[model samples]
Target: MTHIRGEVLIRRPVEEVFDFVADQRNEPTYNPDMVFSERVSTGPIGVGSRFRAAVGSGRRPVEMRIEYTAFDRPHLIASTTTMAAAEFSGTLTFKSTPAGTVLRWSWQVRPKGALRLMGPVFGPIGSRREQRTWARLRDHLEAAAKPPLRPGPVPTRFRRAATSHPPAA
Candidate 1:
């Protein structure tokens, strides 16, 4: 079994960050390796919710089914994932901080079938990839929190009109 853990601090409220991360549909936005991801089960997010995701690409693409095992609103979430090559479980914990929210993620992966023999070689690569994913997640969350920029400088006419007194009520 291989284990990987990482943490990131996002400049957003705990509820906002937790809700965004808990929704499986948001995976592609941050996880570049996720070719596609979507919820397979209906209804609100909670224990038992399931998601299907295709990671990587080409002939060796990995498809996985993720089932939510634990869901604690604005705090923690845990899930089990099964794929043709391996089985893994992951947990994410959210904590409120003065600056923002701190997100901690961990995963335990166990290779199955013929893949077990290569675990030692793949483990470190997987861990590094996960860390990069966390960095992307941080960038995504922080960028989303920023206000959008104005299209351009205000027109001179509009600027002058604002400074001028109204002609009448």
Candidate 2:
């Protein structure tokens, strides 16, 4: 078992952020690795809604088809991946703040087979990877919802640990 947790404050409204993130389809814009995203089933959002997303833009990221295990609008959204290699469950919660909306995402992943063995070596790496991913997503979302700070400049990548390290992103 491995855990990766992160929280970011976004200027976007709670509902806006919640809605955008609730749908996996919106990830490509923020998370650079997510080359494609789409819902696998019907309905805008609810329990049983399914989705499949491709992760790596460079080398075709592993795809995962997951179904919503539970949905509590404007607050909690939970889902589980159907892939045998990876079991991913995540929850997103929002709270209003003076600065903006506080968006918190906690992910618990159980990598099976070969990936499981790397847990000890990569657990910390994965944790930081997720944190960086979340930070990028948050910055991108806020930047998109609001306006650009200057003429043009992408948000800086957030990597707490060295990219050369293991746990291959």
Candidate 3:
């Protein structure tokens, strides 16, 4: 069994970050390797929710089924992901900080098929991939939270009317 653990600090409110991560459909937006993800189960997103997703690209992408085992709004989430090559069970905890939110993950991975033979390398690769995935998530969420730039300068004619100094007429 391989274990992966890490934490990421996102510059966004705890509830906002939790909601975005709780929705499986949002995975593809941050994880480049996730080609597609859709919720398969019914009802609101919470415990027992299921999702089907595909990761990687090319002719034979790896398909995965994910299910949430535990959910606590803005605090904790636990899930399992099963794929042809491996299975993973994990928990992600969210903590509100003065700056924003802190998200930490701990996962246990079990390798199967040919991947089982690559025991020594699997942990490192998985660790790197998981780290990169969350880093992208942090960047994506923070960037989206930024206030949009003010509208470009108004047309000269439109600005003239609003300006305190009226054009010499």
Candidate 4:
């Protein structure tokens, strides 16, 4: 099996980041390689949450069903696939830092049958692709989550500032 890992600093708090990650369906929104994703399990996300993610390959997208094997709040998540042609397992861990949250993603996979034959050709490529995927996820999450929004009306100060905008010539 070949393993690849990557990390990125996220702007959001650990808990918010953890929640987004815990929900498997959120991957497609960030990862450019993900063509689509859907949660196959019904219920709150936890150690048993399952999802099917289809990633866009060069020829066609491949769908893989994955289930969360472990989950720790604001910390760690480990999952493995239960789908054909998938001999892959992965973990994503988050840690608090002064700058922000450090999110790490790792995967180890062995290509079976026909895919194995191309290992020499695709192994390094896949490693790089996986790293890029994680980087995209980290960047998207951090950028999208900046300055949490509160559900309420605009304050008087904000209203006045908006109404007092410089008069157009």
> Against the true structure, what is each candidate's TM-score?
0.84, 0.78, 0.87, 0.78
1-169 per-residue lDDT for model 2 (tens digits): 7776778887877888788888888878777776688887886688899888877634557777877888887888887875556687887778878887887777788888997887665558767776777788778877776655675544355343445478756
Q: Taking the tens digit of each residue's C-alpha lDDT, what string does model 1 give over 6-73?
A: 88888889999999989988989999889899898988999999999999867776899999999999
Per-residue accuracy of model 3 over 101-143 as CA lDDT, tens digit each: 9999999999999888877687788889989999999999989
* Candidate 2 TM-score, true structure as reference: 0.78
Clashes of each: 0, 1, 0, 0
lDDT (CA) per prediction: 0.90, 0.76, 0.93, 0.80
Residue-level lDDT tens digits of model 4 in 1-169: 6776778787778888888878878888878778888988887788898888888876988878889998888799999975456477889999998877888888787778777776665557767776777677778876786778778998999999998999889
After superposition, which runs of candidate 4 have C-alpha atoms over 4 Å from their true positions?
120-123, 146-169
Candidate 2 residue-wise lDDT at 137:
74
lDDT of 1: 0.90
Best by lDDT: 3
Q: Where's the lowest-lDDT run of ten residues in candidate 4?
A: 117-126
Once fitted onto the true fold, the runs of candidate 1 whose alpha carbons sit more than 4 angstroms away are 58-60, 151-169
By TM-score, is 1 or 2 better? 1
Q: Model 2: runs farther than 4 Å from truth?
A: 57-59, 147-169
Q: On TM-score, who's better, 2 or 3?
A: 3
TM-score-based ranking: 3, 1, 4, 2
